[model samples]
Target: MLFKEVIGQESIKENLIQTVVNERISHAQMFQGKLGSGSFSLALAYAQFVFCSNKEENDSCGACPSCLKINTLTHPDLHFSFPVQILGNLKKSDDFISEFREMMISNPYSTEQDWYGKNENENKKGIIGVDESKELFRKLSLKSYEGGYKVAIIWLAENMNIASANKLLKLIEEPPEKTLLFLVVEDLEKILATIISRTQIIRLKSLSEVQISNQLANHHGVDEAKAIEISTYVNGDFAMALHEVSSQDNSQVFFDLFVSWMRLCFKKDVVGAVAFSANIQKLGKEKQKAFLLFVLNLFQKSLLGNFSGMENVKITPSHKEFIEKFMPYVHERNMEALHTDMSQAYYHIDRNANAKILFLDLSFILFKLIKK
Candidate 1:
């Protein structure tokens, strides 16, 4: 991806380009940002610029041989290490490298959940282990085939275990000549302090609502008003905005169910709430979890609307209708309780709690809170 292809973050792109032009590139760098904020895309773009034979002042020349290779992720000098689950005989990152390349080429804006869904069939954890770190060290020990820079990009670096993190500390501290490591992490606090100290951290901000809406209109042929609606719901997450706009299945259904649930809560209809919870439990675990998060966001937006008035709020037509009906129940006295209940539900879901029981419990609590 070229610098211009990435949305917004013009100043950050300029800074990265200037670093390469001045020959002051750091051996190890960390791209820390929220998911879907273009951190990984920026890292890829910077790597392309660094290796481009005909790079311009602002971005890489898209027509160059090196650019073509990087675009397909087949460059000999560029290597990637990401979290992967052990499946069948596929024991390492190398085993899944072909699939990884195809997935990225198909969609570079995917998240860890998307990767896990595409690569693994059953529910399996993805983590970076010691064996992968050993492989990374061995690869970096070799001389670059293209005789330029050898880049090792570790996506979701925070998922690295303690053993793997400790093993790579030495290499991160003192890499071989012309070697660069790009660590992409969603949450910086999860990374070990030792590793964080060794790398230069680059903070990436979320795209503005206008930027996301404009990109949605241009890239996906979405209408401006619909794009703006999705952008507001996504809250600066472009990947999610794209998913919501493009997908016709689960997310759309969840939005409808969420609107209905809020309306039920507002009316204090215990029978409807119980029926809604049962329907939510039938949507599968992933969808159930997604619905819970969606409900939490809806509550937040309602509370924000309650305090700031309706003019400042942005929501879809369905959501706005539900919020208008539900606004009277979400006063300051009950907002904290509502948030806490949603937080507890999320915690239970993360711990693999029974979705049926959890949703029933959450619905009952909302039923009580809304009555007050």
Candidate 2:
């Protein structure tokens, strides 16, 4: 995505643009930000500007061969290393290049969750293992095919294990000539201190609510009032805000399913709960995740509705009725446990865990919590 296409972060964009203009680019830099903050987009745009055959003062010339290649994320000199699960014996990042390319082309603001959904692996932990790191080292060792800078983007770099980080440390210490490394991470503290020291850090702040709202209104075709409400609910997570807008149709379905699941669990209806789990198992990994997220989001709203107010809660009439009745159950005693259970379920689902067992197990936990 071009700098212009990415919403907000104008100052960050200008700083990135000026890096190339001044010709003082760092060989290794970390673009650290929260999920949906557009760190990847910034890195991609920066790489595009660096490799642009006809570079403009503010952005890359989109018509150039280099620009076109980078836009599609197929640039010969551009390589990506991201978290991936072991499919059979294959754990290589290169194995999922086509999907990765398509995903970014469609949504540059995608998170690790999005990547997990794309691969449809059940709760399989995506990591940058030592094997993948060695592969990256091999790829970066080669000279740039186009006779320019080679860009290596390590998406979710914090997912790298110790061995992988060590291997990457070697490369960063003595990187190939004309090579630039972009280590994109969500959590800074998780990364090895040595690795952090080796790279220049560029922070991408989360988008403001207004920025996210405008993006939803203009691009997602959301009405202003709805976009503003969604933005507030999302609390500046553009990826989630966009997701909520795009998946608006599923809102009611998720709501009804959640209510049913809670009722089954609360009533100790094992047969009903098992059947519910079976149905959830059939919804595929992404929808399963969306269901969990929907449930968690509602719990958050209900908690607020119980204590503070529903000023920020965005939902339909059915959800409103449910929350109005359910608010008392979502107390301080159970809110944390409820959120933790659902969040952990979401995480496990991304890792390709068994959905039936997971959902049923979560049902038991919810039953105990709801009893409180």
Candidate 3:
């Protein structure tokens, strides 16, 4: 992956290039960003840039042997450690190397949910176990195969167990000569403080709507208007934008659910809302969180439309009519309350709260807040 291939983050790319050019590369660094923000892609590109023999000023020379190997994730010096389902004897990420490479090749912006899909198992959680840390140490202990930097890119580093984190901390604290560690994290809070203290943190912001829209149109061949709509709807999440394009039915389901839930809230139908909450609980925690995020994004857009005027609102034709009708209710008076409660609901759902009861309480709150 070259810097040119990663969408947006132009400033970050320049800064990373400067680090390499000035020989100020940190031995241990953390690339922190939300999912679908292209942090992983950026980190991979950075590593490739470091390894490239014929490096260009702005990006890596893709035709170079090092670039080719790194692009295919087959470089001896470039190592990867990621969360893995410890199924039977398959305990380490190396055990799932082929699948991991395939996933990255297919979609560099893949989420943990996409990782789960590759295994066809969503129920079992993935983790960076202590054994993975042991493997990391062993790999890094070896001399760089190409007599260059040995780079280890750990994806979803927050999933590391306490033991794994501690082991990694030692490596960070006293890293081997010519070794680089890139910890790619989605949740910075989940990482151990000791580990964080040792590494330079590179924060990545979300991609712009235009960036995502251009990628959708140019690379994915999505129609211009629909691509822009999805880019706006996903709120800078490129992975979600891709999902929205490929899974229109899923978006329709979320739309129908949102419409029904809003109706229940607007009418103050507690009984109906509670029943609806029960059904939503059946979608499982991940889907439940996705739904709540969808609703939150819509509410935000609606509030924007209300305050900024409808001309500023970029919504799909399917949702435009309903949102225009709903915009007035999500004004300054209730917008804060709505955002707070919905965000809290999403947070709790992610932490495995009782979804049915939580959704019920949220529904009742929305009933009062929506029309305030």
Candidate 4:
């Protein structure tokens, strides 16, 4: 992944290049970013640039032997460690090297859910187990194969268990000569403080709306209307944009659910809302969070529909028709309240709050807000 190929993050690319030029490359660094924010891609590109024999000022020369190997993730010196499932006495990432490479090739934007889809078994959770730490130490202990930097890119490093994190502390603090550690993290808060203290942190933030829109249109071949609409709803999350494109009907699914729930609330039918809540609770926590985001995005669209200023809003023609009807119910008085309540619901859902009750309470709130 060359810097030119990775979309957006121009400033970050320049900063990373400067690090190489100044010979200030840190031994241990964490590339922390939200899922789908191009952190992984940037880190890989940076590593390739660091290893490239014919390095240009802006990017690595892709034709170089080092660039060729790193591009395929087959470089003897470029290593990766990510979350892996414990497969019947198999605890180390080495056991699933082929699957890992396949995943890296097929879907670099994947989160834990995608990782689970690839390698998890029996709904088992993926984690960086303590046993893998020993394996990590062993791999890093070896001399660089090509007499270049031994770079270890630890994807999803936040999943490391406490014991594993502790074992990595000493190594990160003082790595072997010319060794580089790239810890890619999604959930920054979950990482251990001790581990964080040992490494230089490179923060990656979300992309802009235009950047995301172009990404969708260019990468997924998504139509202009949908690319615009999805870019609006995804809040700069590239993975969510891809998911929205793949599951365009997901919008309609949420639309149907939203229309039904709001109708129940409009009639002030607590009984109906409670039953709806019960049904929503059956969708599980992850789906519940997705639904909340869908609703929040819909709220923005609906609010814009209240007036003739449709240029600022992005929605399908079919969705615009419903928004035309629903617009009167959403106003400044209620949209803020709705956003706050819905965002709060999403937060609580992450912490394992009772879904049924939470939805029930929100239903009543929506009932009153709709009438306001």
Best-to-worst lDDT order: 3, 2, 4, 1
Q: Give the TM-score of candidate 3.
A: 0.82
**Index of the highest-lDDT prediction:** 3
* lDDT, candidate 2, 126-148, per-residue tens: 99999999998898899889998
TM-score of each: 0.76, 0.70, 0.82, 0.89
Off by over 4 Å in 1: 249-255, 270-372
Over 273-346, each residue of candidate 4 has an lDDT whose tens digit, in order, gives 88999999998886788788878887887787675566677787777777777878888888888999999999
Residue 331 accuracy (lDDT) in model 2 = 85
Q: Supply the global lDDT for candidate 1.
A: 0.81
Q: List the lowest-lDDT window of 10 residues for candidate 1.
A: 246-255
What's the residue-level lDDT of 203 in candidate 3?
A: 93
Error of 4 at 20 (Å): 0.8
Task: Give Cα-based local distance difference scores for all models.
Answer: 0.81, 0.85, 0.89, 0.83
Model 1, 128-149: lDDT tens per residue? 8888899899889999999999
Top candidate when judged by TM-score against the true structure: 4
RMSD of 4: 2.6
Error of 1 at 175 (Å): 0.7
Q: In candidate 2, which residue pairs get closer than 3 Å at backbone N, Cα or C atoms, i.e. clash?
A: 122-351, 122-352, 122-353, 123-349, 123-350, 123-351, 123-352, 124-351, 124-352
